[model samples]
Target: MLLLLSVCLIAQPATCRDEQIPVGGGAANAFVCLRNSQSVLAQWQDEHPEWHVEKWRCAANAAPPKKP
Candidate 1:
């Protein structure tokens, strides 16, 4: 039972997004899976030091953001 519960929790869907500085001098949104977000973002930041992330957000589902 414990193993089953752990599997189910691990299977949950997740989405992550971040706003990063673009070369044009404005922020651009980048989306990535939550599980690999950190490593992916780190590599990107390392390769493109000028495009540092400004903000980040993660959610459990793929649902689109609600309109304000």
Candidate 2:
């Protein structure tokens, strides 16, 4: 099973992905993010004890700057 977490990486407004591993086995992907990555992930962990974070990453939502 593969888990993917896409949490905002840079210091900008972006998306985060997280993969949760079930006790039985296998992984699931979830997209979540708030002002803080740690806090958000922590909350998710607390809510779902049956699953553990496998991997995570940030998906940038910022667009490239326009050339002058």
Candidate 3:
């Protein structure tokens, strides 16, 4: 029973979003989901020192923001 429960929990899919990240001075666009935004953003900043974040927003029906 314990093993079954663990498997079920692990199999559950995480909620995510199609987040838009501006690149190349707003002349281009990029996308990321909730599950990877943290690491993705970090890598983007490191690789593109000149790029800046214009704004970030969740795609339709994406994961809701966590409460404080």
For lDDT, the strongest prediction is 2
For candidate 1, the TM-score is 0.35
- Worst lDDT run of 10 residues, candidate 2, spans 21-30
- Each model's Cα RMSD: 15.0, 13.1, 15.4
lDDT of 1 by residue, 1-68 (tens): 00000001113323323332222112122333444456545765677554435444443333344311
- Model 3, span 1-68: residue lDDT tens: 00000001113334222324422222222233444445556775576454443334333333343311
lDDT at residue 25 of model 2 (Cα atoms): 20
lDDT of 2 by residue, 1-68 (tens): 21224333333434344453221121122233323456556776777555555455433334232211
- Residue pairs clashing, model 2: 5-17, 5-18, 5-57, 6-16, 6-17, 6-57, 7-16, 7-17, 7-57, 7-58
How many residue pairs clash (N, CA or C atoms closer than 3 angstroms) in each of the candidate models, in the order given? 0, 10, 0
Model 3 bad stretches (over 4 Å): 1-32, 58-68
TM-score rank order: 2, 1, 3
Whole-model lDDT, candidate 3?
0.34
Q: lDDT scores for all predictions?
A: 0.34, 0.40, 0.34
Stretches of model 2 off by over 4 angstroms after superposition: 1-35, 61-68
Judged by lDDT relative to the true structure, which candidate is superior, 1 or 2?
2
Model 1 pairs whose backbones collide: none
